[model samples]
Every structure is written in structure tokens, then in C-alpha cells.
Target: MRAFAALLDALAFAPSPAVQVRLMADYLKRAPDFDRGWALAMLAGGFDTACVRPAALHALAAERVDAEFLRLSLDFVGDPVETAALIWPESGTEPCPPPLAEVAPALSSISRQAAPGLLARWFDRSDLPVRRALAQLAAGRRVPGVTPRLARTALAAAFSADLGAIEEAWHGQAPPYGHLFAWLEGRAPHPEAVAGFRPLMPVCPLDETALASLDPACCRVERQWSGMRVQLVAESGLHRLYSGSGDDVSRLFPEIVAAMEGLAGVFDGVLMAACGPDGPPYRPAPPEALARRLGRKTVPRRLVAEVPVFVRLFDMLFDGGEDIRPLPLRERRARLEARIANRTRLDLSPVLAFEAAEAQDAPLVLKPADAPYLPVGPPWRVRKAPPKTVRALLLAARPGGTGERGPDYSVALLRDGAPVAVGDAPCRLESVERDRLDRWVRAHVTGRYGPVRAVEPALVLEVAFETVRPAPRRKAGLALTRPEIVRILWDLPADAADSVDALNAPVSRPPTAGRASRSLPSGSR
Candidate 1:
């Protein structure tokens, strides 16, 4: 338990990937096979059981602490493990929790009805470090910087070899793998490659301004769908659906699983739930609902019926016995067309015509008609974003040259033709933009709070932002992440600028199917 706690702690604060790999490898070498296998499984996010649900942990903690306090702590900290470790009652018993190898298996064998009592026993005997480690495991997984790819890298570091062979051997290997250990020590020959889920190639975002340089005839444009990108593998009489990040989400959508049982190959597609039976095809559900289902060990039947899932096939990665990734996208399109015709719940994603002459301002992706699939690099998108600029009325600015560094700014939008405060961020203005901001600040300064200066909300400025989120702290109830002052909109009057409702309305994540798809400029694909 001490060694496991130490590993989790070191990994949580690990400075770099190399250091993370080194720490994990050191522990793996020192711990016995039984203990190390469990640790590996936990770190790689494979050790999920109904025995330790977040609700179960909270229920047990509610017996000792106030329920409202627990909820508040969870909200403020934005982390479950930290909250549990801090708020759980101190135990008087000797710090002698059972071995994790025994504990995880014990928990798995018990019923959900018994989980609360079991969890209480764990919290009662263990210190915060032990509880934190167990809490992380119980709450599914966390980004300790050691992903499966990194885990494979750690294995590679142990034997001083490249990742190709190590990755090939790791496929389908189970935990407490004595065979892998034996092979590493040169007790056996290298393991043969097995057909398993490989990482899917993702579409690259295009460089928007470079469109005129693209050759129209060489590229094809398609509507980038709104769904979770996934890779489906049906090999050796078994099927697996790996999400883009390489996590096996096969069990999350069993309807899709049952649908693909008859097929065998590697497929690339998007997984959507509760979309279309006909009509407009598929209306992609909110990401939050999908996230809820993905995190559960066993999704409830009620939720499954409410949010039935389906896959929209885009490409075929394998055919018969050959790897089709090396073939051109155009070539694979025909294979996908023939293989997935009129399939139930799973159908071909439409390929939009390359409408080059339609609208020059629309975000367009000019993919080479002959582009071969590459998991990394070899970008296919020519430009993937629409116009990012939006009008905002300058409301405040913070002066520069402080020890905390320099200037900051905040802008507002009109609500019913009156100024309504939005969000603010550290000022990011070019030299020319800064000169203009200085004029506005000097002329409009009305009040000051330390470094922040409240200015007359008169000058209309053009601002850009990455995304928006609800802001309980702001009067406007919305704030932007990664906001930057792009340019001064002198031509657009302050009253005629974008309204608070317009800015606050769901902002589109261009190229993806964000909620405001129609109003927002389409991204180039």
C-alpha cells in the first residue's frame, strides 16, 4: 500500500513524461508481479468495477460529513479524489489497509449493495494518501500523464528497445502477464503481431488563409460530423470499439457492438446516440450525456433506452487480409461504399461535393483526393476555422508593468441596447492594437480598482475567443476562454455591435457540429 501510494503521488506531480516513465519503471522493477500488474492496470485505466462508484463513496462519506459540504467541496476543487482525501474522517485504527492486489479483487467480487460498507472500512483504516490512491482508482481514471502509449513507452525503456515490437506484443495481453515479463528477460522469443484496435487517424484542422493556394481538382471537401471519433476492430471472433484516445469503449454502446458482430475488420467512424431513425439522418446528442454513459462500469437500462447509440462509418481501414491505410482515401471510399451499404444503425457518412466556387469566406478543407491515411502528421485539412472575430465594447482595462506582468482587458456586449458586462482576461494586443487601447483607456477612464480601470463602454473592439462557458461569477452569466483583443472595430458603432445574447448564445466550435451550426460560419474541411 505504501509503495502504491508513493507511485500515485509521484505520478500526480510528475514534472515531465520522461520522469513519469522513469518513476513507473522503477516501481515496476521493485514490486512483485502480482502488485505491479494491479498498479499497471490502475494507471492505464483498465481497473473498473461497480464496487467503487462515486455515488457509493459519497454515500459512505455522508455518514460522517455534511452532504452539502461534500457537494460544495467537489464543486470548488473540481476533483473528487482531492475532496475525498481532505474531507474523509481521520481514522484511529492502525494504518494497515489490506494489500491492493487483494483489495481490488475483493471489491470486484462484492455486490453494489455492499460497496458502501466496504468503502467505509477502507476509509476508516487508511491515511489520506492511501484513501487518495484508492479514491482515484474507484473514480475510474485520471490523467497521471501515463497513458497506454506511455505505458508501452515505459516497457520499451525497461528493455532498451523501440516501441514497435513492444506495442505489438502488448495487444490482447492480460494483467499479471508472466509471458511478457519472461520475454523481456530473454526467456522467450518475441510475441507475434495480433489484429487488435489501433489508433485512428484524425482529420487535421486547415489553415484558413491559405485556401487560394490549394488546387481545387486535387482535393475533396466533406462535412465534418459531430460525434465521437472511434476505431472498430473485429478480429479473432471478438469485437472492440476503441475511442480516439485508445480507451476501449466497447461496452459503453453494446447496441453498436451487437451490430458489428458479423463484420470483421478495422473501421473508422463516428459514434452518436439518440440521433436519427430516418429524416435528417442523425441529430448528435449533447456531449455531456455521452460522457456520463462512457464513465459508467455498467450503464443503466433506462439510460440506454433513452440514449440509444449508433455509428456512422466513414472509412474502412482493413479489407480481407490487407492493410488499406497505405491506400489512398479515394480508393478506400469505394471499399467502404460496398461493405456498409444499407446497414442498420450503421451507415456511410456522406461525402459532400467539393464546392470550391460557392463561397470564398466559408471555412473549406481541401484534402488531396489521393491522401493516404497516416496516424500522425501528413495534415489533410487546408483551413478548418471560420472567421473568429466578433464585436465587443470595451468596458475595462488593467495597467501594465506590474510585477505580475503587464496589461489586461475586459469587454462587454449590449443587452437591449445597454452595456452588459461579460468576461475578462490578460490583455493580448499587438503593438498597433495596444496603441489604440491606450487611447481608449486614457479617454474613457472613469474609476480604478488597483490595477483594473473601469472605462466608458464606448469603443467597439473586435475580439476573438477559443470557447465559452457559463460564468456563475459574472453578471452576464458567460465567460470566454483564451480571449484576445484582435482589432479595433472603429467602423462598427458601439450600439450596433453584437448583443450580449448573441455573444452569450452557444458559441460554435467551427468544423465540429457545435450547437450554433447554422448561424456560425462553417469551418473549412
Candidate 2:
């Protein structure tokens, strides 16, 4: 009963079934003559409540927990709490469980009578699940001398408790699945909240200096690839693919859906922009183009053909058989590569061999063979800093039907003389209506025609133009003349000169009598 009471306190404060089973087992073990039957009943009932019956059942099947006790508990407990809990509706269910009124009275009566104090100690009981139900019941309504204690416990959970500590508790005492939700709701604060989500972890703003400071022998690097971040979750033959933002993308990528058939595990990786007839070199589609592909429910056959996506397998959080996140990155990579084997769609991510240096400049590019790899780094190369290009495009400026300045020109990115992603940026107008565009341009285009007015950031356009005529007054060198409208590229990563000296210390080479080579590349080059 002591074990049961403590469980009641724990469940009252933080409900988790994994704890109930383990606690019940502990009770049965410590008290050889304890109520084995009641413990089993609670285990079965509690596991049902927590929606973690499979894991619990597996443990029972394995005899890791006391099966005899759990069996007994299941037979003895006939409480309405167990009945209501058996059918706890999951998210998106049309109707909720029957109104609380029908069952609340029984729960309230039993709980108020069972425990007179707010935090009723149940350490003497073998089955904690029943006591937990009683606590939830007691806290639901005004119980004499009980409400204050329940509120105090809640406050402690909200403020005094450390989330990191609770997460550690999961390894030692709690269930794994609900930790994320519990942390988000503030029942616990998981420091590794971003750790399990593959795509988000890579994109997360981490300190570069800190990353560099880690033991070089163990640390590695890769280009931050440009593509959609996907978290693939599969359990019991059900598959769900979620974007970094948690938006479900199961249907958007049927190829991926088909690819992961019969697979079970939680993993993170990127879907790349497909390339080449025989799959030349895979690269991520520019963010803008990728967005178009991502927004669709059903992609056209032609579109998928034009822009096939492949997976860049990165970190494997789980394998076909085991949870392996606690393993270091190198180990995780090994398991990931071993479990997922489809060269056509899956490629292993390149590792950045760490070197001790004040600074390093490496282009974050991938080998053609490593296309469609997980956690894509930029294709050019992984370096402390990357190169930037400046281009001007000429575009036809027009007002949309809504009276807003439309896009300027479509944009394409060139890295090492090869076309990469396409970009689009539109002219902006404060008011979107046609008259509003005219009025805004008339007011702001201070020059002779003042033909184009700065508008809101919308309607991407393709623009073609020439050199940057430096203007001190303008933020970006304003395009002078209209030319063939190319794709619009705007707001590229804030530009920094790619001079080697800027990113790293210049290496001194012996001066020779030979003249230093110089050549004029094309204007666009």
C-alpha cells in the first residue's frame, strides 16, 4: 500500500503509466506477501489509460515487471475510472468521452472518501493506478482541506521543478513518448527538446564557436543543406511524415511513402531536389521552388518528374530494432547507414573531419555520389564562410489587378558555374489595389516617371539587368536598365566578400618571378 500511495502522489502530480507498472512491480517484489492480484489489475488498467499498453504488455511478456501481480490487479479492479480510461479518445476524434457528469460523481465520491487530505499518501497500496485515479478525482472538485494542497503541488510542478531533471527521470523512472508534450505544456522542461527532431536540430541556431570547441577528434561538420526538413515516424505499420513545423507531409511524397513501406523507426532527414537523367548529382531545390512542391496535396506526374526528391539520410534516432539516440553521432550514423539501404533515394551524409585551427574555409559542397543525403549542407562546400555573388536583372514592372506592384524577375543561383536553385522577388506596393499601386508609385517614385514604387514583399518576379552601380542613398544598388528578365533572387544570405583573407588567415607562398595570373570572367560570371 505504501508503494501504491506514493504512486498515487506521483500520478496525481504527473500522470504516466510507465511509472505505475514499474512502481507496482517494485511493490510486489518488496512485499512478497503483497496484493499481487491488485497490482496486476492496476497495471493493466493504468497501461490502458496511458496508451502505452504495448510497451507495458511487452514488459509483462518479458517478465521484466511482475505478470502475476498485473494479472491479479486487472481482475479485481472494476472501478468506473478503469472503464472510462479504457476508451480515452485520441486527438481528432469526432466526439469526446461521455460527459464528465455521468462519471464525475462516482470518481468524486470515491476519491473524497478514500483520502481526506489533499495529498493522500498511498505508499501502503500495491496498485498505484487506482490511487492515481482517486487523486485526479479528488482534485477535480472542491474537497475540504484538499484543494490547497493540490494547487500547491501544481505550482511546484510549474515553477520549482527542473525540466531537465524530469527528462533524466524518464531514463530512470518515466515513459519516453509523452516527454515532448509534457515539456511543451511546462510539466517538465526538456533541454533536449530539439534533439530528437532531426531537421529542426540541424537548422536550429547553434553557436558555431561552441561546436568548434568540442573535441575535434569526435566533432564533425557538414554543409547546411537547403531543403525541406522531414521527420519520418512509423509504428505498427502506420507511417507519418512531418515537416519541421510539424505539418504532416505523408501524402505529398508518395515516393517516400512507398520507400519507407514496412519500416519502423523515428528518423530525420531531408528530401532533395532531384537531378540528372541517370541521377547526375542531387541538390536541394531552391527554397522558393521547394515551397511550391511542398504546398501541393497531390503533385502532378510531370512536376515530380521535373523535380524528383531523394532522401539524404542523416541521423538515425531509432533502428529497425533498437532506440539508439543515446549513442554518439558516429555510432548513430553507422546504424542509420546500415538500416536504410536504397542508393537511388537514400544517400549517407558527408562528415566534416574536424581540424584544430583558428579558422577554416571549406566550400560546403557534396560529391555527386552523396546526393540526396540526409541533413544536407549547402552544395558548394562546408566552410566557416561561403562565397556570395552579385547579379542584376532587367524586369518588366507592372501592377497586379489588386493594384500592387508585382514581382521583378525570376532568380536562379549559380555556384561554381552550375545552376542551382531559382528565386523570385516581386515589387512591392503598400496598397494592393490597382489605383493604390498608381497612387503609391506616383507619391514615392520621386524620379521623372517614378515608374516603380517599393511595395510589400509579395509577388515574386523574374528580372534581368546589369552591373551594380553603387548608390550611397539606396540600400541595394538599384537596377538601371531593363533587360531579359531572369529569375528573381532577393535577400540572399546577407552578403560578405568571399575573399580568403576575410574568412581565414592568408597563406604566404614564396614569391616567384612569374607574373600573377589574372583573367576577366563574363559580366554574369
Candidate 3:
């Protein structure tokens, strides 16, 4: 437990990725196998069952400390679990803390009623850093800068194993990963084969200057669809859907899973929702349409019908258990087109002529025709026009997080001749500019809403964004994508700022069918 806590503390403050990987690799190399496996699982956001609710932790803290002091500490810390861990009283004679191997299983099986007593005992046995790590684990939060991928990378580094093979063998295995550890230590054969997610290849923005250098005959162009990138795996009677980050989201989209019932291959594509039947002219729906179906534990039949999704096939990674990723892109595309012929819920992304694609006034993706499907590379390139800029009225200021020194500014646009809050400006202002805005906000406060302060809409800000999309859930009825403050517009009148209609103009086009065709079985919904 102490070693794991020390790893967390070191990882949180590691200055660089190289340093973080070194620290994690060192810890993994030295910790006991059982402890190492559990630590790895925690770093990968597993062990979700071993958690105490934030409200319960707060209640426990109030019982031990003064209510006023607890409230003040909470406001200062901004995290309830951290505040509770800091305010926990220390014992004069501390008992030796239990190992992670013993602690993990006990916490996993603990009931809500028994959790408080167990936590108190553990807090009494551990010091400040260990107590904080234990509290964070109980609250189901990973330390900052440590992601599942980074954990895998560190493990690979620790054992000097192939990272790609490790990733391919990782998904279906559970923690503590005894078999995985045995395989890493060469004490056992590879784990049983399962149709798990393969990491998706990354895409880099196509530099405008390099466009002329690309060979027209050696590259293929496809429209960059606005949807999530996903890998669909159907092999050996196992069908699953994975987000690009390797999360198993099979249950979230049952219709898509059912549509792939008989398929046996690994496919890379964009998963998107569309209106109307799942065939022929594929109308591309807004991201919000697909957003409605994500993150739900159970997909109600009505919601599934309302937001039907389909995958536009990009490339075939596996063809009937054969690892075809070593083949060139041209061969992969040929195999993909042949595999999904006359299939519903799956269709090939049509390839356009380079000149034709260049002439179209839309975003495009360019792929090298001869490159093999590598998990990590820049074989895919996207081309989008520069972001558009608009002048918006600054409406309010929200308090920043723990280490942020300045308040975050909320900007708005005119809708029906009234200012409607659209989103926050994430631009990091220069110290002088930040001070100026802070002074203005402090002087012109209107109303208070918790940590946010409403300010008079007397200032205009020049904001630049990549695109605008219809956001039905927002008061403005639209939302900006990747917006950042270009500069402050102190002289511009607030009334002269752009209206919501201005941002909505480009997105007002009627939904046109993309390269998609599919039909879902009635039983699937």
C-alpha cells in the first residue's frame, strides 16, 4: 500500500512523460506480483466496485472535525475526498498498513454500511500520503497524468515486452491479472484468445504546405465524417464494439452488435447515427443525435429506434481470423468492399478522385494508398479549413480550479436579440490581459450563481472556433467547437457582436446521405 501510494504521488508530480514512464516502470519492476497486478488495474481505471460515495466521505469528515472547518477546507480544496483525507485525525502509535493484495479484495467486497469503519481503520494505520491515495481509490479516481495506455506502456517498459502484442492480449483479461503477469514473467503461455480491441491508428492534421507534395495517384481521398472513430470486432462468435480508446462499449449499441451477428472480422470505421431507414442514401446526423445514445447503461428500445447508428467501413484489419493489417491500403480496401457487399449496418467509405475531392468545399481525409495498417502512425491525414472567428459578448466569470490563478470567462452570442450563454473561452490570457479582465469582472458583478459570477455584458471578445454544431440541450440552441479567445474587444459595442444565427448559418444545410447503408433486425431493437 505504501509503495502504491508513493507511485501515485510520484506520478502526479512527474515533470515529463519520459520521467513518468521511468517512475512507473521502476515501481512495477519492484512491487510484488499480486500488488503489481492490482496497482496496474487501478491505474487502468479498474476496481470500480471498491468505492465509497463522496457524500459519505464528507459525512465522515464532519463527524471528526468541526462542521465550519470542514466546509472551509472543502471550499479551499475543491475535492471532498481530498479534504476528508487531509482533516482525518492521526493516531499516536500507527499500526503497520496492510499490503495492497490484502486491501484490494476486502474493499471490493465491503458493503456501504461497513465501508466507513474499514476506511477509519485504514486511515488510522496509514500516514498522510497513503491516506490520500487510499481515499482517492475509495472515491474511484486515478491520479492525474496516469491513463490506461500509459500504464500499459509502463508495464511493457518494465518487462521489455512488445507493447503491440500486450495491447492485443489485454482487453478481455480481468484483474488482478494473474495470467497476464504469468505470461509477462514467462511462467505460462499466452492467455486464451479473445476478440479484443486493437488500438486504432492515429490521424494527423494535413499541413496545407505539404498538400502539393502529395502524389495524386498514390493517395486516396474520403470525406471526413463527423462521428466517433471505433473498432468493431466480430470473431469466433464474439462480437464487441470498442471506442478508439479501447473501452468495451458493446452493450451501449445493441442494434449495431446484433447487426454484426454473423460477421467474423476486425473493422476500422466511423460510428454514426442517421435518420430514416438503415439503407441506400445515408443521411449523416449531427453529433448530438449520436450523443443521445452514448453513456447509458441500458439502451431503451425507444431510444435505440430514435437514434439508429451505422458504421462506415474505412479499412479491414482482419478478414476471417487472418491478420491482414500487413497488407497495403489498396488491398485492405478491396477486401473491405468485398466483405461488406450487400450488408446492412456496414458500408465502405467511398474513395473520391484527388481532383474531385480537392474541388469539394468540405473537410477531407487523405490516406496513403500503399501504407500498411500500423497501430500508431500518420498514414491518415485530415484537411479542414482554418477556424472561423466571431466577436462575442462576455457575460460571466467562473472560478477556476485549484491551481488556476485566473477566473474563466463565459461568452455569449445574441439569440432572439438577447444574450444567451454559449460556452467558455479556454484561451490562456497573458498576465496583463488577465489582470485587466479580473478587475473588470470584480467591478461589474450583477448576480451570483454558486461559484460563477454574472457580469455586465459590456465587453466584446474575439473568439475563433473550428466549427459550430446544433446543440439541442443548450439554451443557445447551438454550441461552438474548439473555441478560444483571440483577443479582447474593449472598444467594440456588445450589440455589435455576432448573433447565434451567424454561427448557425453553415450548419443549416439539410442532412444528406453519407456513404452508408444498413438495416437492423426487428429483434435487435
Candidate 4:
């Protein structure tokens, strides 16, 4: 238990990735069999204990703490687990808590109603930080900022084991991982690669200067959708869906799984929702709408009905169990187009002629015709996003921001009747509007985290930016560069706020700056 606590504290406080890895390696080297195994499970995101949820803990805390005070504490702490750990009344003089191996299994064995008491008892036995870490384990949440990839990386670093060998063997396995330990310690065979997601062939921002001079015939440009990049790995009458990050989302998206039934081979694509009962029109839902679908493992029926999903096939890495990654992308796409044409819930991502006019409306993924698919890193494909502007909502604001022009406001573009933050910028509310904003911030704020304050997203603002380029930093797998608030847009309705895709749509001529800068006082829009 102490070792597990130390690991969590190290992971939480360590700012340097190298230091974090060293700490993880240190813990793995000393901890007991199943205790260390459980720690690995937590690191690799292997637990989905049907016991207590973060909600239950929050609910339990609400019963004992002052509601307003708790809310304020949550705002300050930036997380619920830490908030709970700090505020939970310690049990009277209990000895040290049992190791995570024992505690976790006990939690998992009980009913949902019993989870609170057992977890509370465990909380009482430990100090604040251990309680916090245990709360996270109970809720099946990862420590903030650390990634599963880093966990795998740390394991490789510690054993001086092959990274690829570690990753390939790590998938679809649970902890108390004696096999992995044996294999690492040279006592057992190298674990076989499981049928799962492959690392992405990352793309870089296009060099617009080189774009014009490059020969079009050597490349194939494809429309990039504002959707989730997914890998479909099917085997033995079942299919699994994984996001680009390699998290198995088979249950979160059952529709996609059913669509891939009977299909064998590895395929890559973007997951999108239907544009109504229309033919061949798959598009991204508003960010919040997609969030609702993604936030649950067993998606509710109404949500499934609300957001029908389909995949726009991107590339074929395998066909009929034959490795086709050695083939040129154009050849792979041709084969993918032919093979997946009649499959349910599947469509080919359209291949476009190298035309300047239509590039902005979608991703122009330029792949060399004969280059073999290199399942990692950039400089493999050049992606371009033409200059554009979006009508976004001023959803929230933060105090004392870190960005040069920031710390004042964060903006969100609307999707499916919910606000989603597109980017943060320096506040640009008009002098008259700023006064009203102060009052609005007080009355309408629902929650907050650190410097960021959440407000009712009823305000509209016009944001001008150079491009909606691909960036790993942003939630939508894209970010706006040089975004400036041109207007407060008080006249525009929140629901009528412009779509994100509108920024990517083709424009016949450049928009005039002055005419488009129409502003309204903050009180209305």
C-alpha cells in the first residue's frame, strides 16, 4: 500500500517525463507480485470495476460536506478525487490500509450500494494523498497528465526490453501480469502480438510554400474529416474498435462493431455521424454531442439513435490476413475502396484531384504513391488547412493566463446544441460589454478549474484565424492559429452559431475585414 501510494505521489508531482518514468520503473522493481501487477493495471487503463463511480464518491461527499464549500473546493482543486480525499473524515485510528491488490478485489466483489462504505473505510485507514490515489483507483480514472503510452514506455525503459515487443504484448491483457514479468525477466517467451490498434502514421502541417511547387501526380490528396480516427481490428467472428490513442472502445460504439462483423483484416478510418437519412454523407457531430457518446462505455439507446455512426475508410494496412502495408498508399486505397464498398457502415474517404479550390473544405492528405505505410511519426504525409474564420461562442474565461495574449477568455464553437471550447484567447469584450460580463460571470458560472471559469455559453463572437490545422494539442485534433476576436456577435443566436466545418468550407473570394466586424453589446448575444 505504501509503495502504491509512493508511485501515485511520484506520478502526480513529477513534471519531467524522464523523472516520472524513473519513478515508475523504481516502483515496478520493488513492489510485491499482485500489488505491482494492480499498479500496472491502473497504469495501462485495464480496470473498469463495476463497483463505485466518481459520481458515487461525489454524492457521498455531498452528503457530509457543505455543498457550496465543496463546489468551491472542487473549483480550486481541479479534480474530484483530490477534493474527496482532502475532505473525507478519517476513520478513528485505523491501521495502515491493505495493499491495492487486496483492497481493489474487495471493492470489485461488492454491490454498488456497498461500495461507498467499503471505500469510505479504506479512505479512513490512509492519509489524504493515499485516499486521493485510492479514490482514483476506485473510480477507474488515470492520474491526470500521465498517459498509457508513457506507462508502456516506462516498462520498456526499466527492463531494457524491446519497446515494440512490450507494446504488442501489452494489448488485451490484464494485470497480476506474471507472463509479462516473466517475459521481461527472460524466464519466458516473447508474448505474441494481439489483434488490436496500430500506432498512427502521424501527419504534419503542410508547407504552403512547397505545396505550390510540388508535382501533383506524385501525391494523392484526401479530404480530412473532423471525426475520430479509428482502427478496426477483426478476428474470429468478432471486431474491436480502438481510437487513435489505442483505447479499446468496442463497447462505447457497438454500432461500429456490428458494422464490422464478419469482416477480417485491419483497416483505418475516421468515425463520423450521418448527415440525416442521406446517402454517403458522413460528418462529425458537434464536439459535445460526440462527447456524450464517448463518455460512456455502454451508450444509452437514445444517444445511439441520436448519433448514428459510420466509418470513412482511410487506408488498408491488412487485407485477407495478408500484410498490405508494404504496398503503396494509392494501391492500398484502391484495394480498400473495392473491398469495403459494400460493407455496412463503411465508405471510402474521397480521393480528390490536386485542385486548389476545394482543399479548405477537408483534409488534403498528400501521400507519396509508392511510399510504404510507415506506422509512426510525421514527414510521411503533408496536411494543409487553408486560412479561415469561425463564429465561436465566448464560453468561459480564466484569470492570470499563461499564454502571451491569453488568460482572459476561452472560446467554444457550438455543435449539437452544446458549447465546446475551440481555443482560448485574450478577452476582447467591448468596454461596454465588459461591464455586463462581470455581472454575468458572477450569476451564470456553473463551475471552474484553476484559472478557467465556466459560464453559460450564450455569447457569440466572431474569430478570425489563419487555418484550422491539425494539432495534437487540441481536443478536436485541430487548432486555430492567429485567432482574433473580430466581433462580439450579440445579434447571433447561440443555436445559430456557425458550424466548425464552416471554417473549412471553400470561399470564392476573401472576406472584407470591416464589414464582417459587426459587433453588438454583450448583454444580448
Candidate 4 backbone clash number: 2
Cα lDDT tens digits, model 4, 1-525, are 877877887776675677778888888888877887877777766665547776788888887789998899887886776788888776668558767888767755778899898877777788776787778777766665567777777788878986667765767566778888888989999776558566667776666667777788887777666678888988656588888777788898898888887788889888877645344545545443465677565888888888777888879888867888888888888888777767767888777778762446444777777777775533455554443557777777776412223246778776666676667655454545565656767787878775567888877766756555554455555656556665665556677566666656623232333233334443322
Q: What is the Cα-based TM-score of model 4?
A: 0.72
Scored by TM-score, the top model is: 3
lDDT for each candidate structure? 0.68, 0.40, 0.80, 0.71
Best by lDDT: 3
Please write out the lDDT profile of model 1 over residues 1-525, one tens digit for every residue.
778888878876776787888988888778887887777766666655445667667666777898899999887876665677679988776788768787667655777787667777887888888888777766655654577777766766766765556654666677666677768778987765456656556555655356657777787676555468887778767777877766678778887778776786788887876544552255555444465577666777887877767787877888756789888888998998887666676777676665643354333445577888766646657453343555678888876431222477888877778877666655444555566668868887999876678987777766676555456557776766556665565555567567766754534222221111112223310
Supply candidate 4's per-residue lDDT for 497. 63
Candidate 4, lDDT over the whole model: 0.71
Clashing pairs in 1: 206-382, 206-383, 206-384, 207-382, 207-383, 363-524, 364-524, 364-525, 365-524, 365-525
Residue-pair clashes per candidate, as listed?
A: 10, 60, 5, 2
From the highest TM-score down, the ranking of the candidates is 3, 4, 1, 2
For residues 1-525, write the lDDT of model 2, one tens digit per residue: 434445445543333333333443354344322233233223322111222223222232223225564455444654323432232222343322222232233332343233332222221221334434433333331112222223222322433453234322222222222443345346765644222223333333333554545454544566556577677766556666666544457787777767677677777777766654343235544434455577565888787677677767666666754766556666677677777765465566666554423244433422222223333342322233322223322112343221122334333323343322232334332223333434534454423323344433222222223222222333232222222332222322212111212112322232232222221232222
